[model samples]
Target: MTKGEQTRRFIIKQSAELFNQHGYAGSSLSDITLATGIKKGGLYRHFASKDEIAVEAFNYACQIVGGKIEEAVQKGETSYDKLMAYFRVYEHAAESPPFIGGCPLLNTAVESDDSHPLLRSKAQESSGRTLDGIREIVEQGRASGEFRADVNAEALAMLTLSLLEGGIMLSRLEGSNRPMQLNIESYSSYLKQFCLK
Candidate 1:
């Protein structure tokens, strides 16, 4: 890659955590400059504005978290195992989140809601992709006769995502992994209802 491209990536890598930890409005230009160790002029050279950088950083954060989820999902042989593996990735989110701050989708959705249109749109797209993936997994399980034929893949996928996100939020707020653990246990039990004996 060219030096300019490398520099832009470096800026995104460093600024990703900042944006994840602090919302677009909460994260100031000075904070980004400090995090990236790039002067304001240098930043402006790479990004047209802080909004552009924030968008890139949010994307970067999502990629990091998404990569981890993909890796875990790939390790499982069965659809149910794959779904469990996806949940396991966030089992210790309060202590060791996939990304620096937490789930990028959750953080961005909460912070960008009705405030930052661009970021809100990105979050919406990312979340839709996640739900689609989970739904696909459930559909596959049903096709394979692993899950019951009558399983509502869409509803189950939404429920899984909601439980996982809510677990992460509660665990982080309480500074413990108990909430996530409980969520995982509850979800696992619930998932069994859709399984074929």
Candidate 2:
């Protein structure tokens, strides 16, 4: 990559955690410069404004979390296992998240809601992708006769996402993993209910 491209990525890498932890409105230009060791002019050279940087930074944060989830899901032997593995990622992340902050999607969703339109949309899209992934796994399981036909894939997917994200929030706030582990166990039990007997 050219120097410009490298610098842009460096800014994103350094600012991702800042943006995720601080939110779009909370993070300032100074924070970006401080984190990246790049001046305001340099940041402006790469990003048009804080809004632009925030959108990109949020994408980077999501990529970090998504990569781990994809890895876990791929390692599963069955659809049910894959769905469970997805939650396991969050459980582990409660202890050691990909970045300093917890789930970026959750962070951005709460921060951007009715605040930053661009960021709010990005967070929404990220959530849709997550739900889509879960639904896909459920559909696969149903096709393979591993899950019951009566199961509502979309609803289950949304429930899984909500529980995982909510669990992360509670765990982070409480400074304990018990809440996260409990959420995972609860979801696992729920998943089993739909498993073919």
Each candidate structure's TM-score, on Cα atoms with residue i matched to residue i, is 0.97, 0.96
Q: How well is each residue in 65-171 modelled by candidate 1, as lDDT tens digits?
A: 88999999999898888888777999998889999898989999999898889989999999999999999999999999889989889998999899999999999
The lDDT, on a scale of 0 to 1, for candidate 2 is: 0.87
Per-residue lDDT of model 2, residues 50-87, tens digit only: 88888888888889889989999999999988988877
Task: Point to the candidate with the largest lDDT.
Answer: 1
For candidate 2, give the lDDT of residue 96.
Answer: 84
RMSD of each: 0.9, 1.1
Runs in model 1 deviating more than 4 A are: none
